[model samples]
Target: MVRTAVVNRVQDLWVSLAGVGTGFPTGGVRVVVAPESRLCPPCWAGIVVLGDSGIATAPDAATAGFLRESLTGRPLRSAVEAERWSGERGVVDVLGPASLAYLDESEFRPATSDAGIARLPTGHPALARLVADVSEDDVGESGIDEITSAVFVVRDGAGVAAAAGYRRWPRSVAHLCVLTSARLRGRGLARAVASAAVADALRSQLLPQWRARPEPSRRLARQLGFRELGDQVSIRIAAHQVDSNGDRGQPGGRRP
Candidate 1:
């Protein structure tokens, strides 16, 4: 009994450390507090952040309802979440299975960049179309523009099937996102686009951050020289109780 209670306490502490709350949808896409939107983190699967908080599964109606009730009017002051790494604070060395293994310059090879650049055209319809087809939880028009350094529409001389983009961040951090059409299933377009984006980020001195979905995708990332940063975990709770500094305990808690 004592061990169980202790374990629960520890788990609760972990939850508190990760600044978690519900994401509310606004303007089509669910708008949760994402610190790295500028970097255009992947929006297809779980949402990721560069700061203390990690990636979170976007809240749906059921999830949102739970958050609204739990947090109420309280404010979440901290940014915390489960980190995939076990370190005090450091760069994520994602160079193993489940990541792109190519060196920085290797990413910029002609073959990779070629497809990524072509997919996203000027004022192309791919953006809106992708959002419409993918999920009702799109970030809307702004999301279309926000997710790309430049958009490319991938085609095989027929019609547009997939769209790709590159996003960058300070301190050598970068990422890629590809929106594929429903008709084109089991195609390798996403991987090609990802390679291009990684190449671009490497050329510009931005470290690549890859967020792959499902086991196969994760395996691809690993093969491509990108390692999983770690599983970003989140939980909902009363916002007022969250701590900003990595410190948690009773209010007016003594300084360590």
Candidate 2:
């Protein structure tokens, strides 16, 4: 558990530094694009500034202190604090890693390919809805097409269950996004799909990193060959509704 937490913390720090952390911009708000093996859009590590007072963008108790000092031109106790704070407002951040582990062939099993399992292109319209279903803030877009990454999915007759994808950038990374429908929880679809994704990542010389908010998910990732990195933080804000036209309730105070 500690190992997974450490890996997560390191991943978070790297993402935060790369500007793709939780509170950073996704599509339109990008300031700089950096190398990341993953397809996540480059984001800002510091606070995301807004044009108007719309959402509360304050950092956590720890991050807030760092922000106040940085803005006032005070000495930083550590770089970690500074990385979490900047002039940017309206963005929430979870900083740190959980645990990390390396992959070995013996620890993984090759999953048989299913003809029904098809790779979903990143540009596919179905992707937008899948992302939206998870959370409004979970989706991001980039003008650079090559930077976009996604996975293939397998639908069991009626509902979706398994997904596998990867990003080859600053570092090679694999993504295993699996959700079992109400009727398919006990089956081994997730394991099969996840193993397949990791196998692909290894072939491409990429590191496979898994994200699980709950302990059980973390445990599963370890069992599948991912080791603990560290624990990180993700500060989530309620996503306000955008009008049917996609305009914010308050003019111009939104993260892209």
State which candidate has the highest lDDT. 2
Q: Model 2, range 1-256, lDDT digits (tens) per residue?
A: 2324334444344454443334222211222222231212223222222211001122223323323433343322222232543223433444432233445545664556545666666565544444434433222211112324455566644434545565553434544445433344456665665666677677776666565454655666776866543222323222332333454332111133
- For candidate 1, write residues 25-77 as lDDT tens digits: 22122234332222122221122232122223322333333323333433221
Model 2 — TM-score against the truth?
0.46
Against the true structure, candidate 2 has what lDDT? 0.41
lDDT of 2 at 55: 11
Candidate 1: regions farther than 4 A off: 1-123, 137-145, 156-159, 239-256
TM-score of every prediction relative to native: 0.46, 0.46
Q: What is the C-alpha local distance difference test score of each model? A: 0.40, 0.41
